[model samples]
Target: METVTRRRTVFDLFVIDADDTLWESALYFERAEEDFILLTRSLGFDSPSVRRLVHSRDIERLALTGYGARPYLGTLRAVLDELCPRRPSWADSAFAEISRALLEHPVILLPGARQSLEWLRERDLPMIVYTMGEQDHQLSKFSRSGLSDLVEECVVVERKTPEALADLLSSKGVEPSRSLVIGNSPRSDVNPALKVGASAILCSRERLWQAEKEDILDPGRVHHLETLSDLPSLLSFLEAAPDSASRDL
Candidate 1:
């Protein structure tokens, strides 16, 4: 018997974000933070002050911890220890509850996430869910998301860098010009796409995290959309319009 390997499919690749882009992620984090804040306030710390410290520490720890639910919870725990040197009897259990809630939260897909992906799938668009975080945790979420069948693959990295994006396209034999990166983060999604000479679509959200905030390097090269539902229409318009006209859009 001879072994045969199928060539990877190549097309105008769609690189999509997972957390807070296709599903409800930040909301659970926000809930956990609020719970932590309440717990700390019960211990006599000011709510706003604890929030400020937690926010600062979260960003500071990213260099060491990267991004994931566990690392984020670890940041909160560190903050709690800093504020309250003497460990309370019930603190550990309460914090564990918070961590469990966040880690085990249901995968609630964003509006039109399914419809948009189905539309692209029906058109034979090659999509890869390119996200960054702890591999097992992210893969667990992807499995529960009910979107696995629609996309070709889900890629999890520790971070999203220009070089990372370039390497992903290279692995798929996809040209940068024939790629579209869609996500909410200006720092992670839009900037990397711009750096790789790929088209970008920013699905803007009201409560993006501080670390994900950054001025887009080239706003003119990125398309802005309110939700995933608009994606199919945008693609349709781009396909119908002349290349010169679509460039400005």
Candidate 2:
């Protein structure tokens, strides 16, 4: 598929994701993963083995437990306890502390995320924070994220599937050709929106969850950027030249 620059940017609505794309989320999860790896390594497993097993269990447990920091942390803890119950490190209170920290980590906005939101807000554009995971957890992240005041509303769901995207666009009366979905997860954000015919902007991150890794299918309506800081300019460029035709990525 040809990597295409957005054909037009005068979108009527913008649906943004709330996790690593907008703030320091996956970093915290990564930190917790490292800590857990260290703790497990102390119990006997090598670093690589621990990482592999943890990742394997994490993906496996998602189907049973769904997405949430608590569930993820629990997966790590369960793996540790199951494999190293007799190890001294397994009894350490520090392990529990690490898990709690992962669940309660602070929500810090990504660089320029706040500024970008304000830029869109000042332009009087409509934006929605559409995210998945536990309702209270996602809501809390949004509240502490300093973005709750900026978006029109926060819609939390169990999954960010194409059907959900279609429903959202349908309910909002947002034409697929005149809307954008910006997020870090191609699995949850880019693919679904593009599948539904909406343009998508993937704000790439350094450490994406394996589950979120996927190929971009409709590159004609899907694009990539390094950070949220780059968003306002892209939107401005697109909106300013709404009649512009697609260009190669």
Candidate 3:
């Protein structure tokens, strides 16, 4: 008797997330948060209280304002206004500067971001940059990222849910089983993708948006790679043992 190898199904469509996955978006926001803390502390507000309030308001405002640089800036400003009714001139100026910094920040690729993307391009995989944010901002980041020439398109959305993922996959005529969703957040990337029967690859990062973290229901179809560069090897392994990918770890 001879052992048989279950050939892995080739993932034709690869939809990758922007932000913390490819470039350093969250880092700037984190820095801005620290700046906000410093500014509020200078205005007599407790640093810890300012951070807590900013985080709280940012999350709550998402449903109403959607995700974007402006919304985040607004949340921090709102916190400042509520705590200090008579905001100083410098406070407003500082907030405006912070907003400009976030909006004008360069798209700095991560350590293995470009190399990994290049590898995928060489392999000729159908890859798309799918992210949730203000359309103009997200597209602008893509243009500056140096990856615009590599990927077919950069998609912007207000939210990434199972339904949204399903629609994207369907629009491309790619079945869930033959598609891959890679991102840092489980809320916006992994869980919703898995729910739609699509395999997800998490570009794991230490510090991520609090809301993006969610429970993974189907770990079998999920693959965790430390960096984007690790993807080629993982895909190779899956090619050899496709059916066993879920239990490989």
Model 3 TM? 0.91
- Winner of 1 and 3 under lDDT: 1
- Tens digits of per-residue lDDT, candidate 2, 205-234, equal 877988999988877667788888998888
Evaluate model 2: give its TM-score.
0.88
Ranking by lDDT: 1, 3, 2
Query: After superposing candidate 3, which stretches have Cα over 4 Å from the reference?
Result: 1-9, 242-249
TM-scores for all candidates? 0.93, 0.88, 0.91
Candidate 2: clashing residue pairs, number: 0
What does the lDDT read for residue 70 in candidate 1?
A: 94
Candidate 2 — which pairs collide? none
RMSD of each: 6.1, 4.7, 2.8
User: What is the per-residue lDDT of model 3 for residues 180-245, given as tens digits with 9 covering 90 to 100?
Assistant: 888999889989888887778888899888877788877766788899888878777766664546
lDDT: worst 10-residue window of model 1:
2-11
Candidates' C-alpha lDDT = 0.89, 0.83, 0.84
lDDT of 1 by residue, 4-40 (tens): 3543232379999999899989889999999999999
Relative to the unseen true structure, what is the C-alpha lDDT of residue 233 in candidate 2, on a scale of 0 to 100?
Answer: 80
